[model samples]
Target chain A: MRLPSLIREVWANLLKKPATVKYPFEKLPLSKTYRGKHELMRDRCVGCGLCAKICPAFAITMRSVYGKVSPEVDLAKCIFCYQCEDVCPRGAIKRGKEYELASWSRNEMIVR
Target chain B: MEALRKAEENFVVLKAFNDLVLDVVSKDLCTKCGMCVSSCQVHAISMTDEGPKSVGPCRQCEACYYGCPRSPATSEELLKASLSSEKKDDILGSYNKIVSARTVLSEVKSVAQDGGVVTTLLIYALEEGLIDGGIVASKSTIEAWKPVPKVALSINDVLEAAGTKYSNCPSLVALKDALYGYDLSKVCVVGVPCQVTAARNVKVQPKAARKIGDKIAFIIGLFCMESFPHVKLAQFLTSNGIDIAKVSKFDIKEGKFRVYMGDAEVLSVPIRNLKDYANRFCETCRDLTSWYADVSVGAIGSGRDWSTVIVRSDEGAKLFDGAVQNGYLEVKDIESDGIESLRKIAKRKASKN
Candidate 1:
């Protein structure tokens, strides 16, 4: 709309670094609290299931883990609210900062 | 005392066993304790996911209905007849002594919920020829976790039914089988509080517990707060990651529900969270100790590995004393605090309804 402002914006872009990263070659910077694919510490999971009870997405299914039952998370349905990690008394689940999770199959996304 | 005889001497025949299914079972008053299923002489009733269902044609006999532990008609009679002491104890119905005891045998203690006193006593009874075979609630052969009633003749049979099952078992079905199929004239019956009442009914209310008649020679009752449904308990274990098929024992202690697969602990849950998985019928039950039983053995007020046995009647005392004297069990009197603990527990259970 304005010739001077348009020229100024182009001049600013030429000197500035790109906002996006070359994801495969270079890792992206993630916040400490960033929610990503979950990680389950099986040793810490006492199978109390408070997370399963409170999960709003209904993505978690309690599956038999050895002699006891533990939750199996479907990453496809997880909204990354980190509610599961928050409710876990044992701190068995955590939302990690690693977000480069591109799977070939939906079945691969299910963490048992 | 006069009212006791007058109240119980004339045992009235109810309309039908279906009346119990309608009035008690269908009304959600059924504890699913298996007294009716075990006591039914005819193959008229069977247990289902919805609870006991009337299957075959009715013969108009009220054995199943009358023998139901939760029914008012039988409950009233059982209460009067079972409480034959000079005065009610308010906590324990009728008792001669309260003691903490354990079966001395290693085989019993290995798989026991506590002292294995009940199993030891049953073994003693079988060996002493006091009983031909007894009806006991145990895990089903088909389904590992589901409870089933069986006629136990040998010590091994008794041991098979040893540990406490949180699920309600239809024990009376086996009692009927014991009387009819096995033709056992004298038999001991082990069950929870309500079940022993139903067993006593076979003695007092002849028309109701008519399937077994007066065949029950001795009764061993367990202390119970409540029992659970089979499906609910399985769901609970699955939710907790307990493989029911691998479970070797089930126990409730120190407000924790534990499932054991051999010596290895499978899963454990605090008892408070277990309420949702419980049988609806057990919620209405007020008997913690089988008040009407000959001997009530439970782990409530005892030491870590001992069971508190309440010796109620002369026959109950006889069996318990016989077991101890013959080296089947090691006995020690309960402490005042232990007795007080039992009293408080029983009082709390009675107040639930």
Candidate 2:
């Protein structure tokens, strides 16, 4: 393109709002059924280990806690699959829309 | 594998691979000590995400079954092998001598659990050529508070493996690792009550135990009340927000589970709270002082920094006397009254089960 046309394009663009959202301040709206992280209801969980069995990535391990087997999820391996939520008979774990999950240490991703 | 081939000349094998699966894996009785997996010459066993799995076309090898601490035939065989024809089974099994002993070597004392008797004896055995090496429990790197059976080849290795692991260690499984991996002709091994019983069963049935027959020279058993699996221990720690990696030592004293990080006390909780973390096999177990072991050792009814060592067999007596005579260990007669306290503790564990 010509220099004059480039100058006109830059000038016209200066009048518009910034395209990227300020993620820390202004959050974007998430879909209603968007699957992100798992939220466990400790009271509802019977530690039956069905979620661990259905996990395709083998991301979940059943740990024995207080005489019952409990689910421990590694968020790093989770492909945002909602199969755990679908398979859970007790509804102990459900997919929630909180996609901002990032970590410096992989250990922080484990939800026991 | 060659031994099994030689044994094939004698008799037909029955219920070898299936027995291990049915008796241990299915019942959740198998301790993930990796013994059965290591003992499998044909590579018939593997530890899976679920637990120890015996994948097929099995050679019908009975090593996995015999090496299992929770196997069905072990108890009856342990009775015959450990006890003589006349001596009846008791809560505190056969013993030639009982004493409170400690390592005279300061190096041994520095890292020793209790009196460091197990470490001291192993060091003596290695130096004197009584055994080629020793097998003891070491912590698993993947998870804290979990134990793996390790073959300690030097004094440094034995000292490093000192202290109670507070979890199930299939230490007898490493007997195979010691012979094959390290190429030791004879070795001593340390284990808990259930594992001692497995070792004794091996001593009785040479055909089933295979090359394990003459490989194990001595057995040092710990007085176990109960032990937990790795998951349960991790869970218990998580509930208290206590990090397992930071723990340096663990001891059961005066009805408490004491955890130490260096000199500082990390956590001290009642033994009752840990019952839930305990394995199901421990619930039915009757042995407390390792009735079947050649020598059983514990801190019960002994002074601080002393171990209550019960020499149960002539082999045990030989080791104890030799270690004492060599000035590696100092011994004092365990008080007659102290014997009563030990008996009471043993009976409590039996009744609880």
Candidate 3:
């Protein structure tokens, strides 16, 4: 309502650093607990298929990799809930902070 | 004697898995007892929710066909092999003694369905070196109240598997795991009547079941009127406004299907109303008392918190006496009225089915 208060507020905001970063150049730091891409530890996996069974989006499918059964996640369909990591009896599945998942081909969206 | 001769003649013709599919499975006479799957030496068969299916090439060994309970090729022979006795009753089958018994253990009684006799005997057998492991139906970790056949090796595992699951569980399928996976020389099997018949058939088949059957130390059969399909039973319970996961126990008593949650009755429906959910193949089953089992136990013809046990074989009588002498169980003679009621129910099931 007052012109002096408005001018003071604008001056203070001008002195403060910007809250955003440039696109594709400077990126914001991700939190340590951020959930993004899935990483499966092949050696630790027991092939129980519990992750595939508990996946609400049906994104995980069990496939034989290197003669041992493991989960292949379809990142395109994943909800990034980290439920697979939670339900795995062996701590095999982990969530990584790699949110830039845009790809030219759909086949690239799968995480083996 | 004539029927036994006929069964032998039938056994002379080797039947394969395809014959089982054609005669029992396709005709809806398969009890889903998992005998064929367990009897397959080559591991060609796997159990599905629909029934047993061939996952690998058939070896044509005829194990699956002859081992099936529905196949008439081995029924009479299996009965004679398991209970070679002269005295037999039309309703109760051949038994050494019929008694009313209850377990004295408080831990087992708290979680058991009726008298905890099954769990008590299993504990006794495991601790007494009679059996290294027992195959029982334990609750599934992923589903509520769904029975999954398991190999319980320890007393804790046996205690965890206590209580009755009113769903069709292919319990004999776990026999392979109990023998091979757990590497147990002596194992016990607990199952329903159809499963008992399957086990007996497995025991009598000399070629395929010789290794597996020899490891089976005892069989405990529970009286089953009929087992409900899991999906349909869950649907029925959900439709009745009961949360499936919250249910702690299920019981069929006094003509009612009761559901309980921690000492509180949550739902009660007439058993007749659940006819639609009963397994279609159960109606063709005639052995209500598991006539081929070593020991048969049921809630019928017994008071509250008690089980009516029928010791069918000499081994069964020995096991019963051992449990009683070890102070794990309390025994009393079943009343004549109790026997009459049990016979009436058994006859009704035999005639109605």
Candidate 4:
């Protein structure tokens, strides 16, 4: 291609609409595999504690009373690395895409 | 000057005008379902009639779709057949006959996770020289699922393992460790059905079969439908504004976890939400009672504060009988209706994938 034509194409491209999503303003559709927020179904939780054991970050904790299972996670310590979601054989702790996680204070970062 | 001005106009003005025109003409595909409205964690997303509109320019955060169940739903609900069968009287009698001869409830219930029957029984075995150590779930820290196969030497340790952990715990690997790593001659391990089966499969720890693996003197199985992922439980507590640090108690009853925040019933979370976090492995499981275990301990069809224990082997019956004889346990022959309920529950759970 000629240099003049290439430069013209480049200029035209620059003037065209950018492919970047406005993000929060213009949200991008999440990919099918995007891992984001963690959700727990209370009734189904048998408190077996496999999720915490497999978590490399050790961010999860199991709580209980009268022998029932209860678990908690600290989002501040989480790296958003979805290892916990993958090893969960029950698919209990799944990744959700709501990724806006900024906070004015350190406490806000603490999920649990 | 005019030529320079024209050149400047050519570079910036035309492009800016074109962008504005394109922006206005473009079709906004945002569906104003208010799904994003409820999904946003920071109130960042709002819906307008003219397609879901964004108010403040987004901070590039994508919290809207992550927690939304409708936006590319991550899970599927399917119909499946059950895998369990009724517990035969012969099987029950055999197990009771064995456990009742060997152990007591005082030792089991005092230190166990919930009712303490399992732990107490295990302790009696260890103390009575029936076994070396009781392999049970032991809490390493307050923040993680209790690791299974933790050998408890004292009554306190046994009590720690007595509770019901409805979440899928990998501590079942402790069985593998017991057979391979620890040179135990006889080990009393507690687990779910899968772990019991795995333990029974091992004949020798090494390839040469040089070291005979430990015999599972007692296999106390917990009844489980499915276990939740630990992270989901934690997130639910926090999202509901419950202080995790201050949480003193957590109970699952009537399909709800009545979370107590400093002695106050702050939240009653539906058990269905907790079910969403269950481990996927449970779907394929067919045995509600570890059929191979010496005895299974769970609350599937029992009244509160009592565990429905199904003794499967002779060894289990002996221990249970012994515990009762020694006045350490209180035994009420399970009613026929209760037994039927348990069987129904087991059959249903076994079939669900």
Per-residue lDDT of candidate 1, residues B1-353 (tens digit): 99888868654444576688778877888766666665554466777667688787655545666567777677564555664444357677778888899989999988777888988999999999999998888778899778788999888888888878877777867876786678687999898887888778766664464425456889899898878887887888888777778888788877788787878877777887888888777777788888888889999988888999988888898899999999999998887799888888788878867
Per-model interface RMSD values are 23.3, 19.2, 14.8, 19.4
Tell me which residue pairs clash in candidate 1.
A68-B241, A69-B240, A69-B241, B34-B170, B34-B171, B37-B173, B38-B172, B38-B173, B39-B172, B39-B173
lDDT of 2 by residue, B167-270 (tens): 77667657767776677878887888877776665565433443464567888899888988777887788788878888878888888998888899888999
- Candidate 4's docking class is incorrect
- Mind giving the per-residue lDDT tens digits that candidate 2 earns over A10-103? 9988987788899899988888788988897765564556577768999999887865557999999988777777555334677777787799
User: Which candidate leads in lDDT?
Assistant: 3
Question: What is the number of backbone collisions in each predicted candidate, taken in the order shown?
Answer: 10, 1, 0, 80
lDDT on C-alpha atoms for all candidate structures: 0.78, 0.76, 0.84, 0.52
Cα deviation of B349 in candidate 1 (Å)?
1.8
Candidate 3: residue A42 lDDT (0-100): 78
Model 1 chain B is weakest, by summed lDDT over 10 consecutive residues, at B205-214
lDDT of 4 by residue, B298-349 (tens): 6655666666777665667777667666666666656557677766766767
Interface RMSD of 3: 14.8
**Can you write out model 4's per-residue Cα lDDT over A1-112, one digit (the tens) per residue?**
5999999999999999997878668887889877676666554443445567656788878876554555666676776776655433233465767778767887665443
In model 1, how large is the Cα lDDT of residue A100? 69
Global Cα lDDT for candidate 4: 0.52
